[model samples]
Target: MAAFTTGEAVALDLPIARVPTRATAFILDLVVQIGLALVLGLIATLMIALMGADSAWIDVAVTTVIVGTLVGYPVVCETLMRGRTVGKLVLGLRVVRTDGGPIDFRHALTRGLTGAIVDFWMLGGFGAIAVITSMCSPNARRVGDVLAGTVVIYGQKQLPAPALAVPPPWLANWVVQLDLSGIPEDLALAMRQYETRFRTLTPAAQVGLGQSLVITVCTRLGVAPPGNFPAMQIIGAVIAERQRRALTPPYSNPELLGLTPAALAAVRG
Candidate 1:
C-alpha cells in the first residue's frame, strides 16, 4: 500500500493514492444516497401525515432533486456532525484531502456540488471522466480536485515529520546563532534532533514542522530565525549571523539567526 522514494527511501514520500473512481465508487455513493433519500422521504411523509400538513409540496420536491441532496445532506451532516455523512457512513468511507488532512467546509461543499453534477447528468457527466483520469495520476486526483487544487488520499492519517538522525553541532549553532557552549550536552542533543527532524523532510513538509521549531527556538533564544532563507539553510547560517549581530556598535537587538536584518524585522514584527 506504500511506496518509497528511490533516492532517500523516505516514507510518506510517494505520490498519494489516486482518488477513488467516480463511476465505480461514485456509483456506490449514489446508491447509498438513493437509499438515504428514500428513508428521509418516508420519514417526512409520516411526519406530514401526523401533523395533517400540506402547505408546500414545492419544498418537498426541491429537496428531492439531486442538487438539494448533494449540498443539503452532507452540509448539514458533516458541518454539524464532524465529517460523517449518512451516505458516507453506510459506504464505509469519509472524505478528506489526499494527505488525510481535514477538509474544510468550503471543500466539503465543493465535493457535494461536484457530486451533484456527476449525479444529475449520468453521475457527473464530464466529471465522471475525471475519475478515470485519477487512476492514471500517481497522486490520484480527480477532475474536481484538479480544478479545485486538491487531491484525495486513502488510509489512516499521518502526521508530517520524517524520522531524522542527530544534527551536527555546527548546524545547531548556525540555526540558533548562540554559542550553545553553556547549554548542557543532553539538552543540546535533544534540540539538535528536533531541528534535524524537520530538515530531513521535503520542503513542503518542512514548513509545517519548521514553524513549530521556529516558534519554540525564537521564544527560547529571544529572536526569530530568518524567514527568507530555507529553514535548513538558516540553521546552517545561524552561528555566523549571530557573531555579526553581536559585533554591532550598540549590541544590536537579538534578531533571528540566518536572516538579513530587514527580513528578520519583517518576520518578527
Candidate 2:
C-alpha cells in the first residue's frame, strides 16, 4: 500500500501493482501486439503480391507494421482509454499521476516512448531492467513511470471518495475575494481531505493538522489565515469556494446568487 495525500490533506492508501500483476498485464498486451503485427504483416504481404510492389514499398510496410504495433498501440490505447491499455483494462489496473490524477496525452506519450526505448525493448534486455527497477523502487515504478511521473495501481479497489466540503455561509464573500489560482491540485486535494476527515481526528490532531494546513493554504494564496474562525471552517470555506468557482459558469456574479455581504453578516451574527 502506498499513501498519497489529497489536496485536502487526507492520506489515501492505495494498493500498488507489483511485478507479478504488472508482468501478467504486460504478457497479455504483448500477445495482442504480436497478433496485431502478424495480421498487419500478412496484409502487407498480400498487398505486395497483388500489387507487385517493389523492395522500397515492402521496407516501408515492414517498418510501419513494427512501429505501429510496438509503439503506436500502447500510446493510442493509454491516451484514449485514460491510462488503461488493453492488458491493464483487463486486469483492472490503471496508470495515474503520482498525485492520483488522470493522465493526459503528454503523460501517455512519455510513458510509451520510455517503455519502448528503455524499460522493455531497446535497452531493457526484454524487461529485465524494468523488473530490477520495480523491485528496487518502493512503489514498483519502472523507468517509464519515473520518467512520466506516474504509477500503476489497482484502480478497481480505490477507497470511496469523501464527502465534498460545503462553503460556510459566513465566509462566502471572503472566500470569493481570495486568489485561489496559486493553490496546486495536490494542495487542494489535501485541504479537501482535511475538511472531510476533520471530525474523525482527535482533538489534538484536529488542532495541529488544521492549523498547519491553514498556514500552508494561506501562504499559497499570499493571504493571512483568519484568526477568529476555526481551522476546519476556514479549510472548508476555501474548498467549497474553489468548487463553486469550478462549477459556476464564467461571468456569473456571486452577489446575484445571494452571496451578498449582508447575507454573510447575517450568517455571522
Cα TM-score per model: 0.45, 0.68
Off by over 4 Å in 1: 1-11, 14-24, 50-55, 64-68, 73-95, 98-100, 118-123, 132-138, 160-269
lDDT of each: 0.49, 0.81
For model 1, what is the error of residue 127's alpha carbon versus the real structure, in angstroms, after optimal superposition?
Answer: 6.0
Q: Which residue segments of model 2 deviate by more than 4 Å?
A: 40-63, 174-182, 190-235, 245-269
The sequence of per-residue lDDT tens digits that candidate 1 reaches over residues 192-269 is 444546546687767765566555555666665655555555443443344344334455533212223444454345
For model 2, how many clashes? 13
Minimal lDDT window, size 10, model 2: 251-260
TM-score of 2: 0.68
Encode model 2's per-residue lDDT on 1-269: one tens digit a residue: 99865433546788999999999999999999999999999999999999998999999999999888888899999988878999999999998777665677888889888888899999999999999999999999999999998999998754333334687788887899998888886687777777777788999999999999999999999999876799999998987787666536783433212222343344335
Best by TM-score: 2
